[model samples]
Target chain A: MKKLRMSKATGINFLTYALVIIAFVVLQVMGNQGMLSSTLKGQLVPICAYVVMALSLNLTVGILGELSLGHAGFMSVGAFAGAVANVALSVSVPDTGLRLALSMIIAAIFAAIAGVLIGIPVLRLNGDYLAIVTLAFGEIIKSIINNTYIGMDVDGLHASFVQNTLKLEAGGRMILNGPMGIPGIQKTSTFVAGFVLVMVALVIIFNLVGSRSGRAIMALRDNRIAAESVGINVTKYKMMAFVTSAALAGAAGALFAQGQNTIVASKFDFNTSILILVFVVLGGLGRMWGSIIAAAALTVLPEMLREFADYRMLVYAIVLILVMLITNNPAIKNFFESTMGRIKSGKKAKGGAEA
Target chain B: MLAFLNHVINGISLGSVYAIIALGYTMVYGIAKMLNFAHGDVIMVGAYICFFAVASYGLHPILGVLLAMLVCTILGMVIERLAYKPLRQAPSLAVLITAIGMSYFLQNSAQLMWGTNQKMFPAIFGKTPFSFGGITISVTTVVTIIACVVIMLALTWFTGNTKMGKAMRACSEDKAAAQLMGINVNTTISITFAIGSALAAVAGVLLCSAYPNLVPTTGSMPGIKAFTAAVFGGIGSIPGALLGGVLLGVIEIMAKAYISTQLSDAIVFAVLIIVLLVKPTGLLGKKIREKV
Candidate 1:
């Protein structure tokens, strides 16, 4: 039975990998055939970045069962840190791909450091308090970034808070112009790069979820007291999950920034965080495959419904509410279960019930 | 010194508005145990209603205020019934997301109906500054402070002396127990939302009058600020909301005046975080022990 269970889990993982690979291949073929729209072509890299974001957020929200309202704060951190690193390395690293990879690594490290700093104090609180603290931290980070000015010159990088005191030489470059964010960034993030990042994120998350620590994290999420009774180090596991999630978000943020000509801190504000949360929630919590599909579909939906520009968000809101209401309704849940049960029986059944 | 006094008065005036808004947030949280993210947008809707009633229809300012309150009260009850009622047994995450969706719905619908133009809120208090002991204050500020005090007193009395208020308290303590004890949990919650929304309307008018910029997104920032105030004061405490709101406003104004204007938000939030870390239940919250 255990072997069967392990095989079933692997089956889902394999399916997820296959789905990503197939989508990449199909999209690549379509682009090569000139069958894709210019707008969609531009969105490919961003879509991949968002998919990675959703997956990382799922690690915290779904598996760890913690609602972080400031996921974008980490993203903002990573974006700026990575962008600065990328710009500083422009001379030393002539290769754009190598520079992008190094920037992402630096971004991940900075974000993980931030995560540790925030998660240490924040994880002490439960429920609403934790959510609010994360939000407060997000706002503080945004406010601080809004006042920060960073410029790179022959003298390396100079950063100032609340004052444009960076005395840049003639050939110096301003990496971050306070509220204007990082501009003139070389677009090094490609669809292929984003795809690799997504695969890496998936592998890391899946491996963690299947490990002993992941079980401890989920156990604490399921019941803190019970997890403690079983000798699980609650703080250590929560921090591990949170920092890992933040690091992934940082990498995704670096990719997202590289995909854009200009990046602003405000772009990763409360609304953006909510947008990511919406993807995670709509995709169904803790379901990696569901998150991937939901994030991609929702990201594309707005673009496709450009005709209904005014009503698009209104429709999205109504749909979100309806989905929550319907999914939570006992009658509907029972209906889905009965139908699924029937289908399973008709197929003379597979392995185990994945859920 | 006089400038500092003026700042203080301005801070109090601003804090009074936040206190009123924070009351709504605290009350709803106490009863429903969910953050109504749409409360901010409700303030926007209320402001728009009042703006239309006064600016377009030439109604008396008092009547406009009353009209906004009545409409917002009904809207709150309707939102509760349509969106939140069915999700009573659902997870908190679902309820929070639904609230966010409702917030988006309100903001977008307001945009669709009112168009995203900024309208000047009519100055009902007649633009005269009140000067006393060399300290100048706006009439709107005085009226706002007085109104906050009056509302706080009235709320205290109603909750202490009224049966329905007692029922609300009971429900907040334990909904299932309250239901079992023959208290109508649904009605109590609906009433809580009604009262909360009505206060939101008053806060909306005051907020716009002080700043005078009536836009679809105007209430969002203040709504978030008031929520921070609610949490700072103690999420479930009424007087705590008042204390938190007032202190938040004062700190924000002082920070803006004395420090970099851009960092004022950061300062206020930093104070909140420090306060929460030191006293997680807020200034006046009663600590409850967790059970296995």
Candidate 2:
């Protein structure tokens, strides 16, 4: 009986992986055939990035029970580092595939380093204080990026590195260019690339959750004192969770920067952080699959509602309130549980009688 | 030297505004043990109320301010009744999320109603500068300082001397015990929200008058800054909120003047991380030991 149950679980896992791979191939073929619109293709990269961000943040907030408002700050670091790598490598290596791979690896490494740097100091603080501190860090990083001058010499014009890098022709222009935004990024965000990244991220997170370290993190979430008493280093584990989350968020940011033709410092502001947080919370905390679904759904929903731009945020606000209300209501939870219980009991009875 | 002094004065004026707003945060957190993220949006609402009264109804700015305060107080009570009351027994995380939701709801609703365009606030005090000892000061700055001081004094008096204030103190110290002692927990909580919201409203009006550009998203930055101030002072301590706000404002301004203005936020957060590492309970906060 136990063997049968194990086989069934393995079968389900195999089916899930097969379906995901098939979807990836189908999407890639569609992209190659020019079936998907340019606008839809343009959005795919950020959506994938958001999925990674939301999933990773779930590790800290949902599983580890920590509120981090500075996820985007780490992302900013990753984006700049990634952009820099891509720029430098594209100049040196003539091969596009090799350059892309190298840039991603560089982005991931720098983002992970940034994560550790931030996590070491702030992970000890718990609850809302943690949230506020992270938020401040995010804002500070954005402001610095906005003010700092970047430039390179092209022809006779001494183009600011930032402007030239963003494809702005420098004549001492205030281009993103002074808050106008960075344009002309290489559109390397293919559906297959995004799908593979998501699959890898999902697998890593899943394995981590199943591993001893993940259990230890969850133990801390369940009961910090009990976990500590059992010789678990709560602070270290929390820091680990935060750093891992930050690295994932950074990776997502790098993907976002490269995918979009235009990137702006203002786009990664406090509201952006809050929006990502909403994805994590709305998806059901501590549940990885829920976050993935929520990320995809929420990303698509706003774009679908673009016609009602003014009402979009208002609707978002309402959905947030409604989601909280429904989730927290005991009656709704009980109703769903009872229905599932009835179905399970009926199946058990039928199987028993047949046996 | 004079320029430095002038900057200091400007910092104090801004700091006082932050202090007033921070008090609302600290007070609500002290009693409810919930971070009222909507408190900042309540300030935005208050500013709009004043704007409508001044622009639409043509009321005097002072009267508009008073009306806004009253409306904000009532709105606070309603929010507590509708959004927070149900989650009183829920986990801290639930309430925090709910507050965030409420904040987004409030801001977006305001946007939907008022449109996203920046609205101009009528200047209550004339934009005349007063100079003394080679330092120049705006009339609005002086008014802002006086207004903050008066509000602080009034809050102190209300919380110290009034019956409702005593009940609030009782509730914060020990909710169950306060209930046992015949203090109505719900009423006290509602009143706390009301008073806190009123203070936020006053700060909102002041901010609008000084800055004169209002948008739906404007409350977010100020809200965040005030939240930091609250933590810096001590989350549950009122006077600590004031001290933290003043200190934060000064540090931010000085950082902008001396260090790169871009580094101001980074420096402020660095201070927060350092302070939290050393003193988690905050500057004026008494260390709390949870009864396991």
Candidate 3:
């Protein structure tokens, strides 16, 4: 029975990943065939980045059962870290692809370090306090960055919170100029790169989820006291999930920076964090494929509904309310289950049940 | 000394607005187990209503204020019934998400209705500064402080003396037990939302008058600040909220005065973290053992 259960879990996961690959390949083929619009083409790279962001957020919010309102802070950290590294390394690395890849690694490393530092104090708190602290941390990071200045030169990178503190060499590249932010970055991120990163994110997340630590993390989420009684190290597991989530978010941020020239700290504020949270929640928490679909759809939906620009957010709000109502209402839930159950039974009875 | 006194007075007035808004957060949190994330947007909604009443309809400013409060009270009740009522038995996460959705809905709808352009909020009170002991105070500030004190006193009395208030108190303590004792828990909860929202309306008017920038997004920052006050004072405590709100206001004003204006927000959050680290339950919150 245990063996069968494990196989079923793997089968479900395989199907989900297969769906992502098929969708990605089909989109790629469509782009190559010149069937896709310029607008749609522009969105492809961002869709991948957002999907990765949603996936990382799901690890913390869904799997870990912690509402982190600072996922975007990690993203901001990654974006700036990667961008700074790129500027600092521009003189020697003629290969934009190599620079982008290297920056992404640096971004993920920095984000992971940040996650560990933040998670240590933050994971010790829970519920609303945790939510608020995460929010404050995001705001604090943004505020600090808003006051920061960084310049790169042959002498190396110079950073300062106060003015006139950094003496730079001739031909020094200014990566961050306080509130003005980093601009004129080389756009090296391609749809292919985003797709590869998504695959990487999916592998790390799925592998982690299948592992023992993942079970322990979810166990603690399910029942903290019960999990503690069963000898689970609550803080350690929570920190693991948070740090991994931060690392993945950093990678996504790096991809995002490569896709765009300008990256501002304000772009990754509480609102951005909440928007990502919406994707995670709307997709159904802890569901990997659901988040992929949700992240892609919601990002596209705003752009597609641009014709009815005034009513777009209004419609989005209505949809948000409706989804929550439908999902939470017992009567609505019962109806879906009954109808779905009937459809399944009508199909190849036992096989349908297994599927 | 006079400059310091001026800052203190200014802080107190600002704090009064936060205190009133914090009261709503505390009251709702005390009764309902979920944070009403939409409470902040409710302030925005109230401000818009008042702005339209005075600017568009040319109503008396006092009437406009009253109208905003009444409308917000009803809006709060309707929101409670429609958005929150169905999810009472649902997990806390669902409820929290729903509240966030409701807040978003309110904010965007307001944006759609009222253009994103900043509408001018009229000065209801005369723009005259009263000077005493080398310190100057705006009439609006004095009125705001008076209104806050009056409302706080009235609320304290109502909760202490009135039958419905007692019922609310009971409901907050134990909803199931309150219902078992023949108290209408739903009504109590609805009333709590109404009062909270009404307070938000009062705060909305005061906030806009002080800053006079009528934007759809105005309520969010103050709402968040007030929530921090509610947490600082103790989430479920009334007087705790008052004290927390006032203290937060003073700190924020002082920080802006003496520290980097851009970093004052960070300073406020830092203070909250420090407070939480020292006392997780907040200043006035009673400790409750979590059951497995």
Candidate 4:
């Protein structure tokens, strides 16, 4: 029975991922046939990026039981770092595919480095304090990005705090114009690239949660003292979860940057972090597929409601609260669960009768 | 040196405002055991109320302040009852997310009502600079410092002396045990929100007055900063909040003054990271031993 239950859990997880893949395939086919609207087509890449972010954040918030409001910071770092690298390489390597793969790798490396740098200090704290530090870290990254000056040239990369401090070569170009940020970034991010990233994020998140290290992280989350007493390396596991989450967020950031024409530091503020958190929570904690669905739906929902421009965010806020209510309120949860169960059973009965 | 002294005074006044807001954070965390992420938005609501009352209704500044506090007190209680009260037993993350949602809800609604443009919130304290011993101080700054000190003293007394305050402390110590002892945990929680909201109002007014720019997003940075302050001093501790707020304010001002203005916020956050790394419990936060 225990073995059966374990398999059942895995089955449900697999089923959710399968549903996501089916949806993506349908969307891709529809797009190829010119059935999807332009607005939705534009949103597809973003949906993928946000899904990666939400899934990555789940590693920390859901499984590891820590709140990180700075996931967007890691994303911004990845975006800028990846964009700069690609911009410099644009002169050397004109191949979009090569740049795409290269930038993603470089971006992930930079973001993971930042994650380790930040996670080491931050993971030492607990609960709300950790959340605040992560938030501050996100804001700090934004400020730094806003103040940063990066200019590229045949001589080499020129970086400085002062905007005019870097004297570029006669033919060299300014990659990041400080507060103006990276303008005209090469748009190489496609649905296919985004899909691979989503898959990468999903694989890491799912396998980690299923692994022994993942269980140790979750154990530490539930009761730190007990886990510590049980000889779990609490710090190591926590850092592992945090750095992994940051790295994925960075990868998503790189993809998102490549998809955009202009990227600014202000784009990755505290609100962005909160927006991703909303995705994780609405999706259901520790539910990877739920996060992917929530992230994709929420990303598209706002654009879908573009007709109600003023009321869009208001409606979004209301829906967020309502989702929270249904998920948390026992009365609502039970009612919804019963309704879902009935529909499923009703379908099963129909199939049985037909057979 | 005199300029530095003036900045120090300014920093203290700024810190005092933060301390008031941080007190709200600490109190709510102490009693409710959850971070009221909307605490900052409540401050924004209060500032807007005061702004409308004084700017539109032509009410006296003191009366305007009182009205704002009254409305915020009610708003705090209402929010606690409607949203947080139901999730008493839910996980901390849910409550935190709901608070975030509540914050955005308030911000978006305010933007819809007031628009996203900055409003020149009238400084309740008259425009006058007090100069003595080669130093200049704004009336608003002096007023803010005095007001914050008074509020802090009053809060200390209320929590340390009053019967309801004692009940709140007891509830914070152990909710189930306090209930078993016949304390009305619900009322205590409501009172905690009410008091915290009222403090947020004071902090909001002074912050707007000092900074002199009011927008829907105004309360967010300060709110986060105050939360940082609450943590810096030690979560759930009043003196910790005050001390943390002051130190954070001073650090921010000094960093901005001596270092790059662009990196001041980052520096402040870095300080918080360092402080937390050095002492995870914060300056005054007690280390609670977890039981399995």
Interface RMSD for all numbered candidates:
0.9, 2.5, 1.4, 1.5
User: Model 2, stretches more than 4 Å misplaced?
Assistant: A1-38, A151-182, A307-309, A331-355, B290-292
Sorted by lDDT (best first), the order is 1, 4, 3, 2
lDDT of candidate 2 over B110-154, digit per residue (tens): 988998899998886767789888888888889888987888888
List, residue by residue over B1-292, the lDDT tens digit for candidate 4. 9999988998898899999999999999998889899999999999999999999999999999999999999999998988888788787878888888788888999999999999999978999899999999999999988988898899889989999999999999999999999999999999999999998998889999988798998999899999999999999999999899999999989998999888889999989988888888899999877666
Write candidate 1's Cα lDDT for B1-292 as tens digits. Answer: 9999888988988998999999999999999999999999999989999999999999999999999999999999999999999888888888989999999999999999999988999998789898889987888999999999999999999888999999989988999999999999999999999999999999999999999999889889899999999999999999999999999999999999999798999999999989889888888777879898
CA shift of B92, model 3, Å? 2.1
TM per candidate, chain B? 0.99, 0.97, 0.98, 0.98
DockQ of each: 0.80, 0.51, 0.67, 0.66
Interface RMSD of 4: 1.5
Native contacts retained, all candidates in order: 0.72, 0.52, 0.52, 0.64
Q: How accurate is candidate 4 locally (lDDT)?
A: 0.90
Residue pairs with colliding backbones in model 1 are: none
Candidate 4 chain B, poorest ten consecutive residues by summed lDDT: B283-292
lDDT of 3 by residue, B14-131 (tens): 9999999999999999999788889999998999999899989999999999999999999999999999998888777778778888888899989888889999998887798999
Task: Label model 1 with its docking quality class.
Answer: high
Error of 1 at B240 (Å): 1.3
Alpha-carbon error at A13 in model 3, in Å? 2.0
TM-score of each: 0.97, 0.89, 0.96, 0.96
Give each model's whole-structure lDDT. 0.92, 0.80, 0.89, 0.90
CA shift at A183, candidate 1, in angstroms? 1.9
